[model samples]
Target chain A: MRIGVVTFPGSLDDVDAQRAVRVAGGDPVALWHGDHDLQGVDAVVLPGGFSYGDYLRCGAIARFAPVMSEVVDAAHHGLPVLGICNGFQILCESHLLPGALVRNDHQRFVCRDQRLRIEDATSAWTGSYAAGQEIVVPLKNGEGGYVADEATLDALEGEGHVVARYLGGNPNGSLRDIAGIRNAAGNVVGLMPHPEHAVEDLCGPGTDGLGFFTSALRALVG
Target chain B: MARVVVDVMLKPEILDPQGKAVHGALPRLGFGGISDVRQGKRFELEVEGEVTEERLAEVRQIAETLLSNPVIEDYAVRVEQ
Candidate 1:
């Protein structure tokens, strides 16, 4: 399977995401923000970063990037896309997912091994995990608080669209402790935590996040 | 050239940490009695042509689509003399 990792000008985790894809037995493709072509990859990963210097808002400028128009269209057509951190912000900005990520309620950058529970494991990016399973991954960001209206929140919860929920404690004051969420179709998922960072036991807290990449491979192959 | 200003603010329901931080430091610095503070962004756009009602509407569209995120923010647009 081939997975594409998009690198925006300020992307910080594109290489790591590609490595994770390779580690999961998938060929990794490097994609550019300035190019509109997707290179015909089966899956797309928007790595974490301060894209376009995070000007105006996090992921705001990148949302209008030449490549993003292609991503938005591909995502709607059932192309599996996983967005991490700033990638998640971009997905929300692109309207591929619901809600927004605001500045941390504490007004500071937070970097830690965050515990998350797999709330919905049936999504394209999370099928390798079992529902209700807990995993720890690196979570780092200044603007990571997730928020939405009551109706939308209730709908997300009621429809099983929430992919992950924070475990142990709410790190950034995200509503309902939502760490990640998937679109209604379950093909596009937006996660604040860095699953790519946790794919290796040597450099990461553990190999708890490898399932995300492997799940995409499985979704593509199976 | 005419200048159009757009003020973008987080919706009342959303928390503004930067704004709250400023609000927190006020009383400590003896600037008291202010109940709250909310920080927002102001964008000024320079139009090359005359500022017509149509242009103002276009600016409003820009404010709605680019200057602010409707999901979490509200924006006001006006032409400055």
Candidate 2:
């Protein structure tokens, strides 16, 4: 399968995301933020980084990039989109995903190997893993909080949209220890952790994140 | 001329360290009345005409692009004519 990774001006994790896609036995395409085209890729990734220097607000500027218009349209049609960190920020800004990410409650940037429970591996982006399976990946962000109203939160929980829950402890104080979530259709996912950085043993965390990439692959094949 | 006020706040998912720090310090300052505090921003813009849906949407796009982070914050727009 072919997967596209978008590169915004300040995207720091595009390379890692591409590497992970390759490691998952898929071809990776590099996409530019200013371009409104998806290059016909089956799946797309909004990689992590301080887009536009996190100016005005993190993920705020990049959410209006020309490319995201296409990403949003594609995502609505059941095209799989996975957003990591700042990428997740863009998704929320665009309203593709519900809720927002705020700064860490501790008033400092937090970085660590975060453990996450795969709450629903049946989603399009997480089909390879068993439900309730736990995996560890790197989490680094000054703004990684996830928030929504009580009613919305309950709906997400009831609809099986809360894709992952934080394990070990809440790294960024996300509501209810949520680490990731899927759209109602389960084709789109937004996660605060850097799974791409953990897909290899040569550096960073172990290959626990390989499941996410491989899971997307399975979704494509099936 | 019409005026619109936009209030942007971080969604509950994100941690507001700044808000928490202030909340933590308020008790030491002999003012323990504050229960919760979150820091966000507000925007005021003037528009040329009536606040149509299209105009509001354009402004929303501008706010999303220039004023707020959707990942961490939610924004509300209020207009007065």
Candidate 3:
């Protein structure tokens, strides 16, 4: 399968995302934020970073990038899209997903190997794991707190749209310890942790994150 | 040209860590009795022509869509004197 990784002006993990895609037995394509084209990739990953210098708001400005317009459109059309870290913020800002990420409640930037429970393994990007499986990946961010209105939160929980929940403890005080979530259609996912950074055992927590990329491939094949 | 100002603030229910930090520092600086501090952003836009009621409505639209995220924030727009 061919997966596209988009590079915004300040994206720091585009290369890592591409590497993870390659490690998962897929061809990786490079996409630019300023371009409107998706390059016809089977799937797309919005990598982590302080895109556009985290200006105005994290992922707020980057959400207006030309590529994001296409992404928003494609995502609505059931194209599989995974957003990591700032990418998660972009998804929320673009309204592809609900809620918003805010400043960490502790008022500090946190980096750690975070444990997460796969709450819903049925999404296009999470089909590799069984429901309730646990995995460890790197979580790093300043504004990673997830928040939304109570009704929306209830709906997300009631509808099984929550994809992952933080294990051990809430790293950024995200609401209900949510680490990641999927859209109602399950084609779009937004995650705070850096799974791409953990796909390699030599450099990260472990190879647990490989499932995310591999899952996309599996979904694409079937 | 007329200037329009938009002030954006986090929702009341949401926690404001930056504002909390500032609020915490105030006691050390001998400023007392301040119950809270909620940090927010203010944007000043220079409109090319007269600031009409229609223009203010447009600015309000911009404020809602771009200046602030409605999910987490609220914004108010007004013309500067």
Best by DockQ: 3
Off by over 4 Å in 1: none
Model 1, first chain, TM-score of: 0.99
For A166-214, candidate 3 gives per-residue lDDT tens digits of: 9998999899998999999999999999889988868998999999999
For model 1, residues A1-222, the per-residue Cα lDDT tens digits are: 889999999999999999999999999999999999999999999999999999999999999999999999999999999999999999999999999999999999999999999999999999999999999999999999999999999999999999999998999999999999999889999999999999887898999999999999999888
- The model with the greater DockQ, 2 or 3, is 3
TM-scores of all candidate predictions against the true structure: 0.99, 0.83, 0.99
DockQ pick, better of 1 and 2: 1
Better of 1 and 2 by lDDT: 1
Task: Give one digit per residue, the lDDT tens place, for model 1 in B1-81.
Answer: 999999999999999999999999998999988999999999989999899999999999998888899999999888889
Candidate 3 residues lying further than 4 Å off, grouped into runs, are none
Q: Model 3, residue A105: displacement in angstroms?
A: 0.2
Give per-residue CA lDDT, model 2, range B11-56, as digits (tens): 7755567878878889898997788988887888998878889999
Q: Which regions of candidate 2 fall more than 4 Å away from where they truly are?
A: B1-16, B22-38, B42-81
Q: After superposition, how far is residue A73 of candidate 3 from its true place, in Å?
A: 1.0
List, in order, the clash count of every candidate structure. Answer: 0, 12, 0
